[model samples]
Target: MKQRPFARLRAPRSLAAMATAGVMALALTACGGTTKDSASNSGSGDAGSGASASANPNAPIKEGLKIAFLPKQINNPYSTIVDKSGIDAAKEYKGEAKEVGPSDASASSQVSYINTLIQQRQDAILVAANDPNAVCGPLKQARSRGIKVIAYDSDTNPDCRDIFINQASSEEVGRSQVKLLSELMDGKGEFAVLSATANATNQNTWIKFMQEELKKPEYSGMKLVKIAYGDDDDQKSFQQTQGLLQAYPNLKGIIAPTTVGIAAAARYISGSKYKGKVVVTGLGTPNQMRQFIKDGTVTKFQLWNPKDLGYLSSYAAAALASGQITGAQGETLKAGRLGERTIGANGEIVLGPPFTFEKSNIDEFDF
Candidate 1:
């Protein structure tokens, strides 16, 4: 029996490494080193560097064909959903899909994990990068070693990966969360944003779009007083939330788009004396925010079903790895049980629309 490891895949770094190796292989193909072997070892630190790159792109994989699904954090519900999605896909594809990540979404830690997976010579990798550019170098090397790479939840440099499995349009995710906050505050009030790491691509993109959307006339009265970074640490998020309360005595609402930040903030608010005075809104798990919603600490919050996100991400990765979709714009692919997904111009696969959670329907979910 082939044993699977606990750690997830590292797609961005692996893809980046592959690209770098491809360039070097092209130059060294005539110098005794085979293009196939050099390409496979580009980013992967694996000793097996002489594999044929000309092997069928959609070759039949085996039961032990390893595919890693690395997220920002393994314990967070948001990332857990992504991990589960990849897991489900691996099961269907007759292979191993493992989940691994840094404890606090550290870029350096992610790079280290990528190096380890390359050394293992895993078949493929799927990742949600912490720092986009930082992961690219390692990913390029993984690609050089002939390992398929897929980016899901967040992207890396396009040249580094075969496909990027987007949960939803980044613009849509940003607009949706901001729209939820607008509704919670009735489009008028002093609101603050509690975001994740300052360098996180997904959060920054959403925040930028939210800021842009707020500038429109409809949200003219909604003042975004401050933006705080929690680094996705629970204690830090709690401290930041408490600070926000003290710093903005007149603040009416708080929007925390990152799962860890929002849940930590919600816990602080729910346990505080000022619970009813302020509204908490953002992306969170139904299970984590259930009590807050019931006690009126947070009237409502929003998040898409994470299990579904994971399930779809896995399918997208497998399809791309197997050459089912060419990772081209304007393409479409089928997601088992979830129906068909459209491939946008940037090689992104939109899973579906985002879903919201409130007191009225919070009990329907467990994670």
Candidate 2:
């Protein structure tokens, strides 16, 4: 017998509704032969004309459009799940979807993959940038070759990508983590952050917001002891967790906003004397954190459905590739099952709020 976690105030709407409602109708008016002008440009379509002036002007209105997803690293559990969901969405639209990226989360590793996708003439390239500026050059080249560039999960520079599919509001996520940690620590004592790579755009943004949240009077007794980077590696994060305990014997809690870092920290604490002594909480999938919660190592954690994030990103990419939306602020487009989404400032599309998972309900979710 398993218990369901209590519903948090920020819980997203039923994902079951999106999965069961089925895929949206594919608009086929944009199909058939490519215009000679578009075909003449090195087998890829012309950036200025084909991308902006297709007959349907909304895609993927046609079949055979190739969309590629580049995660920060290959074989990562979180990235694999998210990219596979995107592939499923592409198939629903009768288009081909490919996942390609380096094995490690290096800043420059994604650049070569972007260039390869451009040469392959992919219609769209969706990326989770390892570093914001490192991949901008290659992504700009992809755009020049008529490939619609969209950032998902993690973002590149604004000038490099046409749109960004953000998983959740960074400010909200940061504040929520602090709120959870405060409750676990009794609103006082010292805590540390176990983060991903130091240069990760999303991690840094969320950390900045967490720093701001700490300024509130309620959290004044909650001192931030240190910030440690694990490079999103399991072994490194475990070591960092051990180091945190050794350095700050009075540390009362740890907030790890990255999936990899949080899980690693939990694993370390679960097997050590720190278990029950230090509270661990942050963003994590239920499947990954279930045992931790059951063992009293982690009280709670929060995250949006990664599958839905990928699904929305896939549709957003196809919409741009088919010219349905131009990534403008205030432009709106429909995403299959998830409903209509608007392009917010900085060409961003928010999926929704993160949900809290605990022993009462961690068993209810599989992703």
Off by over 4 Å in 1: 1-63
Q: lDDT tens digits, residues 128-241, model 2?
A: 988999998877777766678899999888888888999989898888889889988989999999998888999999999999999999998999999999888888999999
- Cα-lDDT of candidate 2: 0.80
Q: Which stretches of candidate 2 lie over 4 Å from their true place?
A: 1-60
Shift of residue 296 alpha carbon in model 1, Å: 1.0
Quick one: how many clashes does candidate 1 have? 33
The lowest-lDDT stretch of 10 consecutive residues in candidate 1 is: 19-28
TM-score of 2: 0.87
What are the lDDT scores of the predictions, listed in order?
Answer: 0.70, 0.80
How much is 250 displaced in model 1, in angstroms?
1.4
